[model samples]
Target: MYSQLWCRTGLLGLLWLISAGFMSAQTPARTELTVTAMHPAADSPLRLGANFSLRIHYDSPAAFRLRIQGERQGTTIPGITHASPRYGPGAGEAIAWLAFDHLAQLDRILLVAEDAATGHVLTSLALPLTLTWSADAPPGAPAPVWVQELNQHAQLAITREMQAPADGGDDFWVNLFLQAVFLTVPGYIILQIALPWWTRDRWRKAAWAPLIVTVPMFLFVVFASTAGGSNLAPIWLLLVCPPACFYLVFLALFFWLKQKRA
Candidate 1:
């Protein structure tokens, strides 16, 4: 009986050791990755036609692969080379170079890391970027001929006509003529027909009131024809049409009431 008890105890001890080993094998290791630094920092603007280098420092428990992606104005920016996988328990870094060759309204970059073995994403970071023309660049200076040629194949092309010098001589005279006609013709018709009919008894005296109002209207028409024509033409009409319509309605109502009383 004593020999049997000793045998049973040894067998139980062996099973417990095996069970502990299996549990240890099944539990996943807790791996951590932390970003320590980024060169150029965040939200930095770069000059157009300039080359820049970027670096990212990180601490991780195991080896990982990094991917760099860039976008501008909702289009992908090309010419980014991704770095190879780096192994580290303490510190590691990745580097990349970029060239800004095209114009962009808004730019952004993304850094992503994945576990080398499992292909699981370990970390990600996004940075805002901007590309702007150099402030010291001379005005009206043409871009390099190569840059102009490249622009033709670019997703956001910049045409030579867009960069051409502004010629406002013909446009200015045409706008002025249209404005004068709009102002004078309308007032003349109203004074000759509408005013005489509406105020037949005191037509001579009341004519000056409409003419006085015409001065400001003429000024507004001039502004709309000149300044508004470039970009604000539709918006100018939206603003001006409502008030002009309301004024006409009021005048018609006033004439109706006067006729009713008479």
Candidate 2:
């Protein structure tokens, strides 16, 4: 009788241990939250004082909430400008229209996701951004007309007036004309005068080269000027002058080389 009782006790203890082990094996692992995509892209330019869209795609097994925080000089900028479906579970996307009302200088933006139930941080992402005027506007200027038009159609209300008149002004016409003249004059000079006069038969084959190389940049400047604003004089100098000078030097080198060989 004593042996049977001891055997029965051992059997019960073994069964308890087996059940505990099974329970431990059945428990689910904690799911890690991950961000998969963002819009306007990382390291892309953002026009200051404009309403821009930010979209984030993420995956999570548990319920989560997302928040965007913009900081300049370590201080938070307030105003819940825009966002959609801020909280949910599993894999999903969130979008927001953010305005930089107070962005006098460049600001750092943080996208933070947290566990909804426990209020613990799940994941955080940093967006490398530059809050500047579009390649056309002057530094520290308000958002441009095209940008403002974009905002008027968006969820946010942008209040800045369009600086350029609808009828277009003398300054606008003068700038446009100068841009065209600048692009055309250089090409004409290189193709008609400089290349023919300077380079020989063998090197002349590459005469169209300078115009071909610089035309794309010229077109880009024209497009930027039209869409961004009429004030692209500074940008024109930065884009056109250095490359033009370099191309001239390259042509000179080629001429010298060909002449030396001849």
Best by TM-score: 2
Clashing pairs in 2: none
Local distance difference test values of all predictions, in order: 0.54, 0.57
Q: Summarize candidate 2's per-residue lDDT along 101-169 as a digit string, tens digits.
A: 443434666777767665566777766565432544333334445444433433232122133433468
Inter-residue clash pairs, candidate 1: none
Tell how far residue 13 is off in model 1, in angstroms. 22
TM per prediction: 0.32, 0.35
Which consecutive 10 residues in model 1 have the weakest lDDT in total?
Answer: 149-158
